[model samples]
Target: MTDPCGECGARACEELFHGLLALDHSRAEPWGPLHGVSVSCFLLQHAGRLPADGGAAARGLLQAYLDGGLPAVQRLIGRARAANSHRVKAGAAPGGAARGTAVPVGREAPRGGFTVTIEQVAQGGTFPAAGFPERVRAWAAATLEVSGPHSA
Candidate 1:
């Protein structure tokens, strides 16, 4: 596996992927904060996986969570079944059309990078059972600060 991804310079992405996948996503007693919070932040930080509009898509989604928490994210993503049905009918695939393609309409993407990469997240996110949620939040917040409107 990539120690630090060549494209995004983040070392923790693969590790974070595992940690996120381990979380309980079941409708019953889910790890609520994590389910809504982690992915967008990861995408924002990773940068390379982002749509052609750049990590703007991810940053905007992260801002949604920052602005209104889980409910806001849920409102943005809405019911999964309904979203999937709509996606199928519209012939739209998940992750949008493809790489280098236009992202769905939204504000222009952030400065297109991260000040704190996933290496820090992985270093800090070890021992997932120990304060993982807070660590993720802090990492994401740091990333957002640099990716925000005044990044220079």
Candidate 2:
């Protein structure tokens, strides 16, 4: 089988999941990169567990990763795009087209569900931008692709 979405080794998933669960439970702000929320939720929904505290202490480092880690992000995006392309070529579904690749109108995709949040934190605070959630989400997905074993 293909790599399990939740098993990707990027620790960002752990952090994002905790932060998002905190947000869902109204404990913490729904703040981080969008990728973080997406991957975090993906892990939670698909894996049935998240790290304790969701790795909050590592959030700043994850955010910095989004802000400056271009190479890692690009590699992840490449893998994701290639994987999606393969799915499309294999006639999996219509909506699985890779990012930055044009998809035909009215194409249906498989039920791959994900969500994200948005927030703004003051400078020197926890989250640095309103779009932090999106960035986090991207990094989380990227890390999953490049970091650890593709399976739990």
lDDT of each: 0.56, 0.38
lDDT of 1: 0.56
Q: After superposition, how far is residue 96 of candidate 1 from its true place, in Å?
A: 3.4
Listed per model in order, the count of residue pairs whose N, CA or C atoms clash below 3 Å is 0, 17
Write down the TM-score for model 1: 0.59
Model 1 segments more than 4 A misplaced? 1-12, 24-33, 79-130, 149-152
What would the per-residue lDDT of candidate 2 be over residues 17-131, giving only the tens digit for each residue? 5555454454344442234334433433332333332322123334434555634544555565676674466655332312222222343211223332211111222344466
Put down candidate 1 lDDT per residue, 1-152, tens digits, no spaces: 55666544666567756665566354222344555456656655554455565555556656776677667767767644465664466655444424554433664444335555545555555534455555656666766786662221
Q: What shift in Å separates residue 108 of candidate 2 from its native position after superposition?
A: 34
Q: Residue 77 of candidate 2: its Cα lDDT?
A: 53
Instruction: Give the least accurate 10-residue stretch of model 2, judged by summed lDDT.
Output: 116-125
